[model samples]
Target: MKKSISITLCAALLALSGCSQNTSSDALSSDISSAASESQSTASQEESSGSSLQNGNGGFKVEGTKLLDANGKEFIMRGINHAHTWYLDEDTTAIKAIAETGSNVVRVVCSDGEQWTKDTENMLETVINLCIDNEMIAVVEVHDATGKDDKTALDKATDYWIEMKNALIGKEQYVILNIANEWTGGWNGELWRDGYTESIPKLREAGIKNTILVDAAGWGQYAKSIGDYGKEVFDSDPDKNTMFAVHMYGTAGKNSSVIEKNLKYAIDNGLCVIVGEFGYTHTDGDVDEAFIMKYCQENGIGYIGWSWKGNSGGVEYLDIANSWDGSVLSADWGENLVNGENGIKQTSVKCSVFTKE
Candidate 1:
């Protein structure tokens, strides 16, 4: 399900007044600063899309905190997450510039097949160029409003993801498929249990050998139940490529207890875990991002920020005046404010805690 209206969060997300930072932002100025070339030789596009998940050599291995290249090199993915805006925007020089900033990967958002129009495919093809030009990896995802643990929905979404994945098969050699965005099935456990198991095989059979990311049920709000199932499915497969994902909404969970427990169990069981999403929300009094980031770094877990709209998701909500925005990161942390707006652009090509620290 999709809606065009503004989404004010429940009490947890609604406590925005405390958002340390406040300001209108053309936060993506970096993206706008420099533009990418729309001109790519047809042959180059064909070659990249032809490349497979399996790298030069077969039998993929783990990379530094993320999936390894097929050749067994520990993959270090520096990247961004594009939750929306594809079909509508045909030209994205800023996107390529994002890759240039040193992000080795990007997570592209997708709705179930219902939203895949001819335009979407074209935009996706261009994204392939952005990834290829920057030598970055790609993560494709499904975004449903009220995602249930329904097979029909999962299949449709998976199909949509594959179409994008398949198109880039040869184009970008390093693309991963994320099962769904957060996975909220009204907190129904059994339904999730049955649905995920079935969906995995379907994706695998499609030649999607890239390690897939599965989310904790309840939009990653309930790690206990979601973690339990993650281990079960993982243990059953006997493979090391998959990872269990959780979305971190500061105070959204009962406590850090949920995250702490999930991390411990995933480690003990030898299954990989990642904080697929989290932002500046004051989910807990502390904002909790450092915990998740710190834990991931210490434990070899991978993390992709909730977003990179001028890095505004965190900065804007924190009320940090983006030095560039001058005013501040805009209040529309999760929504779009302007389409035609353009100015100062992304100058940096790479980002990460390891680098910053």
Candidate 2:
């Protein structure tokens, strides 16, 4: 989840220039724009696959806004987002250390050879095995698409999943595939809708069946998109095995009222949602992390704090642990997220998928 500040000069120029004269050239341009818009709408509809409850790998399925295990038990994701892609050296023990915090799930960041070193099939297998051994649900994500505008990177992420099909096919009980960390930088509901509706089914097509999780727009903070277009996205999934993620930061996670409103909106609207990434503080703005934890704990909504260790570039405070070995915890962010009231230790419940019961 990255946000690069940008200002489009053309938008400002258009505002200053006002409406252009409707000359013959302008009329022709208007016609072209209308046609392009219509064409895109039609293409989105065509590309969107119909809904199904196929249960390809027969592991977890979404049943009326709840994540159900193969045994039909509810699995709330009380977890943490581990930055494995950024901190490759910690790959060996991150899952176990996070599991020791009493978390039932772990969202691991990954790349598809696009931006960072590719997490090879062997690496993925290691990560998945580690989660299984530690009795945690592994939600692997592609980070290369973070804050991207085009679908090329998203498509590449899809292809990467297909390449690792052999490792993923039978692990549906323990794994969930997060399509992309934050696939688009802009808030184009149509683009986000069309992108997932078209690309997600490819996994089922390749026989890699796992519950899918898609992040919201605006670098995973624009939760309004979920309120606006969530139903359409849910209906687009062939398996109906999908969940939505919202990363609360300065924009959408600023206050207690705002946090409660966004969480209520998604749950009230009958869409399964999780707080994929959040922190007590950020350069973007202060996050009401206390309210976030309390709200999720009370509502039975899944929540995972920003990270375990290894954060930098002016946001080093996000690192929950002071060291890579997970010995020391940070003063504010780490302590609040993991051990404070309404924190993971107090609220986390292990998924039935792992327990023998």
Candidate 3:
């Protein structure tokens, strides 16, 4: 994904775009209990009107294509991606503002101590808490894995998560561990499978029970990666609680057929799949955002538009919102994503985890 020409002038065109590895088991257990307790006081009030009281596992589980809570109620993700790592200045109100847009989920970008500033354990706590406070499902991803062909970057991401296991100990229901964003190094299926198979056990062993989300290779645009080996990766998890994510842009999501095939291959096989990030137009190609939103809503698949703001390079047109506060939205990308016919506001259902009583 090379940068387009300096999009600085695109405005004229119309842009819119853990406790550590060594902590004792008992101590970890206690921390999990306390964190769960701390959030419940507020969580109970945030539940969806039809959602049941969430307790063990806080109600997030996968059944076919749907993400069901403890009550077996569906929680479809209709939300936007936030590049928090790249725009730290917006951290103060990103979550709050994202929630205000009627998003039931927020994919927060973070560095895994490799390509960008390391997100420490404390920072993870604050970020996750912010998501909960705003009643949105937090999908945390390590951005360092982008275009990485070498498994080293993937391993490093795993290690980073293990180190921050403390913050994730008991937040299974409120957060999803997106192992790495587009770990698309060479499109090697072996690396993707072996990487997750090896790392997932480490997380489950560490008591990080959050539903693990593994991105498809090929810069996350290759949906076949999941269709080809999604089951193995899903079963590899000791908890059998893993989901596959696909990032669609011009290459893979240019039309309705491509979109349906990619998503259906995974869902047809009885696995949970989600479109991790996508845009109406990209430096790579023109994305069929309309088909994406329409199909996902009709089929029960979760979808998050590729970002609120801070899009640089030549792809400034990808930004869904005009500013950090999200007060202004772009004509095509931003407006279509949040307010269009099949947009988030029209299709998203708040997760029972955040609103169930």
Candidate 4:
């Protein structure tokens, strides 16, 4: 069994911003305990409101803060992000290799002809089928809007999803439509909320019903944006089938306290969230990857490490597997995330839908 941390020690480890040095440990503990209780109460209320798989349109659904697969079984995404748009040729074999690590999901990056070559409808179908063949869920995301605060880019991405309806309309049971990766560049919570609130309906109106995943603003590190307006954005979805995601790099993953506080706030708000992307370390600073994996595991949250391979721009170290076929894994990030305690290999369970007769 995975080791657990006490609430008190967990609170104590929080940064000074969270727990003042002048504050007594007892007071800190009391505050954290209250928050935890409130979170549980809120989750219970959400579940009681009929937010279960029965309400879903035959696809993934969010119940309270848990994700239920098409089979109505709880599913936690333990997987890696594969940059398919950049390394299209490697995906065929790379996805199979990723499945070998016991992962149950793969966040496949694609472009909408805005920033990179548009992944044609045929290519999209091929990639999603590859993941399904490997017994993993496909999280299809458009990379064109990364770090763009402009609403036009986000709209274009939405348009791309609509154009690919032929490939996504019937794959709701096996695919997640991540609207656009890091759609906003700044930490403007209001803008972030408005952009998604506007774009989500467009996708729904276009006949897309897959569970939508929206990344946090500020290049996906601004968890504060999600904590502040995640509910409003989620409510914008007419289907109420949207979930939030946060990319944890140095800015958001520098310490245990920051990570806990960000993720806890989202969970406490009764929002379905996942660590959509995270690296062991980044140019901004070092990341507490160990805590991220441990906390997600114990809390029944989901995480997808960034990435499978083919990282560039001086961030090549972020690649988890060195060889495309996964014949050799990186010594630090790859080894630990895939094979270490609380890692994918130790915790992932294939979605029950694949096993059902």
Candidate 5:
């Protein structure tokens, strides 16, 4: 009987593992408690800041099959993922701090099930506002429950994305929609592909022609998943404005080579690529950060930090910087955001790197 129960538990674990890890739907760490309340108001502010970049009218119209900036210069994402921005419910201050790093893009994430609220639309607008207010770009991530049941999951996903599309149309420059965060489908390409394909027509119908990035299966750490994804995207004939995203964390037993390879694949395949999430907390991790940043900068790829606040499995909160327990944040895999400057030294950068600077 005990053996049967153990087998059942393991099977359940395997079943749950197929969903995206970022959408765990688990309780957030304590740090997010106070921050949750403010995230929603700020979330709506995603592109709210871009309006300020406007000319005589309401900012420049940003219509691009590909992402080219106002000057037609290339704009790539080199930024941090604001943790609990949706959970804590507040942290426009962190957005301001991110701008100091010479970064204009931020991956703003909300914990699971937060999007069902009408208030989410308002929050998204506000967050977009703050991002643009800080002259920063926002990569909006609705990292939420990806059901184990494929048909139901895909249908439910379509519903959620349609809502986001409705709220995000007409806004330009300050926001890009990342469909799901850290897909850990455990090799279920069918589910990922279906979810992505369904979203394109719906989003387009809603007038959201902006760049939409889709993540891969396998905890977002697998590179080969890109090949399958690339195939599916081609098969589905998705809107030309599609990109591929991957998340990475080095110390969490991830393979970095896959990241580099997948990034190349996405770029070579005529799709924009983004390291939607990464965190840097170690000294040596600086080198990796520099390489990825420089490569992405040169190649038009994008990246954002794992988080801004002090959540575990993420970089330390701004107050702690790259140190945990008063020590360096360690050689953990995702240690780039807190220290990715790559020996580029300046007061603002220094301030961003150490949190206390």
Candidate 6:
């Protein structure tokens, strides 16, 4: 769902440095810049692999800019985001409903207690198993860091993932650990770069090896940051299994040229990326959802819509389904996103791991 901040402020400040729910200080930026620059050479030395890295371990791995499933087949995500933390009761049925749409993935929202109720390890395990049972890959993410520049909060979210090792480990074949959703509200690339560059190693050291997914700065709308320093973050992982994601709202998706340029910047740089979250219309402005889907489909890039249900705070329209059971699909947003041209139904292909040999 679109952030629940003041849209008026966002709209007024849209042209100037873009709109972010929070702001960062120059002192913080300077400190991060110094720390992040120290690892520049080391990250640059690690080249992107051109061959599949699956290794028969039954886990998703990155080869260049492509995401290969456990079977070593390229898997392009086409799915929707589910607010599982906000609507925990819906998990058992919601996941099954989402799978019925022919989606190949589902980005499940979890909380680290920074802003919402913390989802315990048991709850996370349940959500993950539900996706696997339905044959859909689960992209689990912590939502507390959305649109915030506080490194402590970001680190706390990271800690949450490390603590969930019991639930995440050994499920690499079925899970993607999205570090945080829309972290670092400011447009400072160095902050986004340094923060993740520092955090990636912590996760790897702690033994959470699922392909880590990192969102762009400026509320996940700033793709230029990924293009500028994404390689550094990607290389920070000893496993070289990190993937970048950009959330498309009005700021980044207002037009076709902006959308294509943002996406191509990372792709051209040999980085694996995906549209982690997007909506047709947003508080910032109207989004070119059609072009987003069309471009991703044409290029073998992956995309997931904003949400399945449970949107509020003046952004309820973003909900794709009117009911948790998915019995009634919202007229335009839900229907078009799922069944319309270049939508998930037409483009999503189940990962080979789910098919019988």
* RMSD (Å) of each candidate, 1 decimal: 15.4, 13.9, 10.7, 11.3, 16.3, 11.3
TM-score of each: 0.65, 0.84, 0.84, 0.85, 0.65, 0.87
Model 5 lDDT per residue over 1-357, tens place: 001111001122232211001222344457775558556645655444333332111212222213444333345556666654433444556667666556667677643353333336766778777877776766776554332324454445456667766556666445676665644445566666666676666766766655566665555544455655765664453445566776544421123444466576555555556776553332112224455565555555666655554553222322223432223433443234444443111111211111221
Expressed as tens digits, the lDDT of each residue in 1-357 for candidate 2 is 541111011111111100011223222345878879877866775454121223345677776667776656677888888888767778777777888888999988888989888999998998888888998989999988887879998999999999987778778888999988878767777888888888877777877778889998767776777888887888777777788988877656778888877766577778888899888766556789998898888877789887887776567778788876667778898888888999989888887767666
User: At residue 32, what lDDT does model 5 achieve?
Assistant: 75
Which 10 consecutive residues of model 1 have the lowest summed lDDT?
335-344
lDDT leaderboard ranking: 6, 4, 2, 3, 5, 1
**Which digits, one per residue and each the tens of the lDDT, describe model 4 over residues 1-357?**
000101001211223222001212333345878879877866775675433345366788876688887766788999998888888899898999999989999999888998678899999999999999999999999887877779999999999999998898878889999988887767788999998899899899989989999988777777888789998998999988888887777777779998998887678888889999888887666789999999999998899998888777567788799999898999989999999999999999999878844
Among these predicted structures, which one has the highest lDDT? Answer: 6
Each model's C-alpha lDDT? 0.49, 0.77, 0.76, 0.82, 0.49, 0.83
For model 2, the superposed segments whose C-alpha errors exceed 4 Å read 2-56
lDDT of 1 by residue, 1-357 (tens): 112201112224322211011235342334433323222333455455313333432433333234555533345343446544433352254445444334456666655645444326666666655665555666767666234555677666667666655554543235566777655544555666677677777666666655677776665544554545665665433344566665556543234554566555555555566666555454343345545555555555555554544333233353212322223334443221111111112111222211322
Please give the lDDT score for candidate 1: 0.49
Q: lDDT of candidate 2?
A: 0.77
Model 6 lDDT per residue over 83-186, tens place: 89988888988999999999999999899987888999999999999999999999999988887788987899999999988898999889999988888777
Top candidate by TM-score: 6
TM-score of 4: 0.85
> Which 10 successive residues of model 3 have the least lDDT summed?
14-23
Looking at candidate 3, what is the lDDT of residue 346? 83
